[model samples]
Target: MITDTNHLTSLREQFAALRAQGLRARDAARKLALSEGDVMAAHAANQMHPDVAEHSLYTTMPLDSDWVNLLQGLENCGPVMALTRNDSVVHEKIGVYRNVSATGLMGLALGPEIDLRLFLSKWHAGFHVVEHTPKGEQHSLQFFDAHGRAVHKVHARPQTDLNALEALVQRHARPEARPVFMPGSPLRPPILADDRIDAPGLREAWSAMNDTHQFFTLLRKFEVDRAQSFRLMEGVHTRRTPLVSVQWLLEAAAGTGLPIMVFAGNEGCLQIHTGAVHRIEVMGPWLNVLDEGFNLHLRHDHVAESWLVTKPTVDGPVTSIELFDEQGQVIAMFFGERKPGKPELPAWRALAHQLAQGPVTVAQTEAA
Candidate 1:
C-alpha cells in the first residue's frame, strides 16, 4: 500500500527540512513523512489533527470485533455484478442487464435505478435461480451487474443452476429494493442512424410505443447522447431522421481551441468520454486527438485525484500528464487504440534526464 519510495523519502526530508527552518510549517511537517507537496500543505493547515474525543471513546470501548464482523458479512454476500457494466459515475444512462450465466434470456431495465427485481420482472418474467459454483458454495442470486469499465467483474456467486440460484436469492434477497425505471411520458424517438434497416425499424418502434414503454425503451440508450439529433428534431417533431455521427461531433470539437480527450467510436459503436477533453475526432477505429505529450504516471487501480508525472524515464521520451481522481487512483499512461493491422504507440517514457529538468512552465506574466 505504501508505494513510491522516492515520494516517501521526499516526504521525510520535506518535514525534517521544514522543522529545521523554524517555521509554522513544523506541526504540519512533523506528522508527515512523505515529501509530497499536497500532503505537506495539508499538514501545514493542521488538517491531520486527531479527533481526541472520538479517539478516547474508541480507546475505552474498542469496536474492532464489531468492525470485523461487519466486514465478514459484506464478504459473505460475495460479489454481485451490475446488469450492465456502465461506469458508476454520477450520471444517468441506459444499459442492458443480463444474468452472467448466459442461461437466462437477456433482460432489460428502465434507468435511474437498475436493480435485481426490475431485471427479473422485466427480462426473466420473474425467474430466479440458485447458482452452485466450482467451490461447492451456494448463493441464491437472480442477476449480475457487469460494470466492466471502472471495475471488471461478474456479480454472481458460484453456485448451482437457475432454479437453485433463484431459491437462494429469494432466501437472502431484499424484496423492497427496486431499480429505477424511466417513466414514459413523451417517447424519445431515435435520432442517430447506423443501418438504414435498423434505423427505420427503431423509428417505427418508437412511434408505436406508449408513454411508459417509451420511457423504459429510450432509457436503455440514455448514455448515448443524441443531443445533436434532439436539436435537429426540434425543427420537425414528426418523422425519425438520421442524426450526425459521433465522428462529426469530435471533428467539430477539434476546431475549438482547447485540450480535449475523445474516445472515438468507429462504425456504429458508442464513444467513450473522459474528463481531460478539449477536442476529439475519429478516423476509422483510430481516434486522433491533440497530443500534449503528457502522461499520468500511475499503475493499474492505483487511483489518485491528481498526478504530477515526472518526464523522461530510462526508456525514451520525457512525457508527463497529470491525472485527477476523487477517491480511487487514476493512472496515466500513453494509451492508443488497437487497430486491426496497425501497431500501437508505447506509453510516455521518463528518462533520467527529464527528471533533472522539471516540466517547462509557461509564465502567466509573460503571456500577458
Candidate 2:
C-alpha cells in the first residue's frame, strides 16, 4: 500500500489539477476517491487565515462550534438560496433565512420564502466556500456529517446582503491547521425479517390512518423499513406506479395550475416547496421543476420505485406520489398542498389520479 504521506501528497496535487479543468469541487472530489468535505478541509487547513480567503477559496470552522448561533447569523443575509439534497434529489429555495429557531439538536427555518427542518446534531464539519463560476462569485456555507456527505448548503444570491455575509464569515471563522478525523464503522441499516413484519396489523393500522403524521408512528410500532412499509400496504393504502409517473405528474401539475408540495431530504435536513409550478423540464435523465423561488432536480434514472400513495384522513383521502431509490430510500415525495381542516384540492387529486391510472392521456388543461 502507498504510505499515508504519499497518498495525501498525491490527492492534494491531483485535486489542484482537477479544479483547474473547470470541474466543481464536488465532482473533482468524487473523481479522486475523496469526500468533498475532506478536499475543502485540506485546502482550508493549509491557508491558516480567514480574511485572505476569496472567491474560489475556503475557510474552515470547528464542526462542534456554536452551529445554531452561526446559522441564525445568516438571517442578515437577505435573499440567499437554501439548498438540501439526497442521492437522487436536489432542492433549492431562494429567500431570506428568517425565523430561525432551535431546540436541542433540531432547528427550523420558517421563513415565508424558505422552509426547512434541520437536524443539527448530524453536522460534523463546516466550511465557508467561495467559488468563482462562469456567472460570477458564489458565497456559500456548507455543512457535512461524519461520513463526509453534505447535510445542507446555503448560497448567497445575486441580491444577497454581502456586508452581512462577510460579517457572518468573520464571526464563525476558526483558522486551524488540523485535519478532520472521521470514525470507522459505516452505516448499516438493519431490515426487519419478513416473518417478523406484522402483515395483518400493519394493513389494519395503515387503513385507519387519520393523518400523514401517524404514518411515522405506524412505522415505529411495526419496526418496518420505510420502503418496505409501502410494499406491505401495496393492496390497501398504497400501490406502485410506473417509473414514468414522476415526469407525467409534474407536467400534469404544470398544465392544470395546481399547487403542490415537493418534499426532499437527507439525514440532516428536509426542504419543502409549496405552490404552483410553471415549468416542468426533462433533459436526458434529469427531471426538473424550474419555477420562481423553488427548483427541484431529480435523476429520473434513480427512481427504482414510484408509488401512488393514499392515507385516509378526517379531511378526506390525502394522496402523495412517493419515489424511492434502489436501496429502498425515499428520493422525493409529492402531494397536493393542503392546510389543516381543508380537504385536498380537487384539482390536485384529479391530476394524481391520472398518474395512478397510468397511460391515460390527461388532456393538458389550462384551468381558470
Candidate 3:
C-alpha cells in the first residue's frame, strides 16, 4: 500500500480528475497504474489524516477479516446484487444472500437466487464502500485478493434493507485496521510436454468416471492441463469450436426459449445463473444479456479458445460450452439447466451438436 501522505494525495487528485471524465473506478485506477484495491485502500478512513474528512468521491471503511461471518450477515440485506467476474466476462445476479455456510476456508451459498462457491482463503481484505453517485448514495461490500484484485462484490438494491446493512457494517467495521497487499504472482509456466502424460490411463479413468465432480480428480491423476486433456480426448469427448460459437449458442438458446446455466468466476468465487435468457444485445465487442434478474457482459474478443466438452454422469452425458482466454484461464462456462439425478436436457444436447456442426464463416469470426 502507498502510505506516504504526499503520494496518497497525488493519487487521489489524479483519480478524481479521471472520475470527472466519467471513467469507472477500475478503469481510472488502471490509468493511474494502480489496482482498484490499491486505490480504495489509499482512500480508506484509516489512511486519511485525523483532521481530514473522507474523500468526496467515496468513503471506505475497512471490514474485519472474518469473511465467513460478514458474508453470512448479508442474509439480512434482502434482494441485493451479487457480482463476480474475470477478465473477459461479468456475471451479476439480483438475490438475497441465504444459507451461507463454511467449512474451514471453503464456503457455499445455496440460496435459490444467490448461488456461489466461495474460496475464503483468497479473500484477503474487505471494505464497506459508499459512493456518492449522481443518482444518490450507493452502498456495496467489496472483497479483494492478496494481489489487490477484486474477488466478489455485493451491492444494495432498492428493496435492500438499509438498516440491516448499516448495522452489519457497524458491527464488522475496523476503523483502525490497515490492510496490506502484495504484488501479484508471475504468470505460470506452460504445461508439461504431452509425451510424459499417461494418455491410456487418463482415458481409462475418464471412461470409468461416474460423476462430473470427479473431473478435477482425473486431471490431477493424469497431471494434464484442462485444455490439454480436451485435446487428448478430442474425438471421443471434446471438440474445438470457433470463437463465434458462444455468440451463436446464446442466440440459439434465446430463440428456442431454452433454460441454461452460465458459470463465470475468478479465483475467489464461482457464480452461477440458471434459467431462460430473453434479451440479447451486442455493443461493439461486448455481448450482453439484459434480463430482469440476471445480466452477463462478455468480451468475445478476449476469447482465444472455445470448446464443446462432454462429461459423463450417472444420469447421462452432460455437455457444456467452455471459453478460455489467451493465458489458458477459463473465462466462462455454459450448460443446460438440470438438477441432480435428472438426465441432461435433450434440447441442450441438440444445441451443443448444432454448435459443433455450424459453419464458421469469415464474417462471423470478424463480427465476433
Candidate 4:
C-alpha cells in the first residue's frame, strides 16, 4: 500500500496524463514502471481527498475478500463480459455467470457461454472500478494476484442488470479497507535437459492416459516441465510445428466453419472459448478473432514455439495445438470442440495434420 500523499498525488497526475494520451491502464502502468494494481490502489487511496477526487478519471472501491461469494453474486448481472489474459494473449467472452461453485481455493464457472477455471489462492485484491468514459460510465469488477498482476475482470454490458450489480457492490464494498501489493517474483528458469528425465516411464505414462486432464498429473508424477515432457515424448505423441501454426490454424478453422476450443489464461484464471470463429484479422503483431460475444487478441510475435500434441483418451485420441513463449510458459491452446463421450472431429484432426506438415500462406491478414 502506498501511503505517501505526495507520491500518490504524483501517480494520479501521471496516470491521468497518460490516460489522456489514449493509453490503456495496463500499458500506462507499464510506462510508469509500476504494476497496474499499484496504480489502481493509489487512485483508490486518492478518493479520500476531495481535491483529488474531483479531478480523477476513475474511482475504485476495495471489495470484501470473499471472492467466491462475490462471484456467485454476479449471477444477478445478466449478460457480462469475462476477460482473462496473459502477457501474449487477451480472451474476452460475454455471457452470464452461472454454475459458479468452488471447493477450497479451486473454482469453476461452467456455464455454456462463460467457462472458467479459477485458482482463488492467487487472487489477492479486488475492486469495483467505475471509469468515466466519453460514451458513459463503465463499471467492472477487477481482481489481481499478490504480485499485482490482473487475474480476471468482469465488465458490465448494456444488457446487464444495473440494480443487481449495484446491490452486489454495496453488499461487498469495503470502503475503508486498504489493499496492498507486493512485487512480482522472479521467473522460473528453463526446463531441465531431457537426458535427466525418466524418458521410458514418461512415455509409458503418456501412452496410458485415459483423459486429457491426466496430463497435468503425468507432469507432476514425472516432475517434468510441460514443454520438456513434450520434448521427451516428441516422436510418440508430440510433434513440433512451425511458429505460423497458430495463424494457419485460426484461418483454417474460420475458413471451414469449424467449431474449435481456445484456451488462454494467467496464473489466476483460465478462460475458454468454444464455437466457430468467423472473422480473423491481423494488425501489426496481433492476430485477432473479432466475433460477437467473443474476441481474442494474440501476439503472433511472442510465439517462440508451437506443437501438435495427442493424448490418448477413452473416447479416442485427443489432439491440440499448444503454443509457448520464449520462457516456456503456455501462451494459448487450440482444440476441436467435442463433448466427453465424443471422439475428436475428423475434419479438425485433418486440419491439425496440415498444421503439423508445415506453415501455409495465410489466406487473409487485412482487418475486417
Question: What is the model-wide C-alpha lDDT for candidate 4?
Answer: 0.89
Better of 1 and 2 by TM-score: 2
Cα lDDT listed for each candidate: 0.27, 0.79, 0.87, 0.89
- Across residues 1-368, which tens digit of lDDT does each residue of candidate 1 receive? 12354653455356446545654222443255321222322222111224531211111110111211221223334333332222111111112222222124322222221222122212210112222224443322122111101111123433213453334333443333222222222244454443323434444443444332343455254322233322222323222111222222233323332222222211111122233324343434333444232111112222233222222222322222222233322222212222223332231122111212332222311221
Tens digit of per-residue lDDT, candidate 2, span 263-309 = 99888899988888888898888899888898899999999999988
Best lDDT among the predictions, by candidate number: 4
Quote the lDDT for 120 in model 2. Answer: 81
* TM-score of structure candidate 2: 0.89
Where model 1 places Cα greater than 4 Å from the true spot, the runs are 1-79, 85-121, 125-368
Tell me the TM-score of model 1: 0.19
Please give the distance, in angstroms, between residue 121's alpha carbon in candidate 4 and its true position after superposition: 1.1
Clashes of 3: 0
RMSD of 1: 23.9
Residue 64, candidate 2: how far off, in angstroms? Answer: 4.9
State candidate 4's TM-score: 0.95
Question: Ten-residue segment with the worst summed lDDT in candidate 1?
Answer: 56-65
Model 3 Cα shift for residue 295 (angstroms): 0.6
- How close is every model to the real structure, measured as TM-score? 0.19, 0.89, 0.94, 0.95
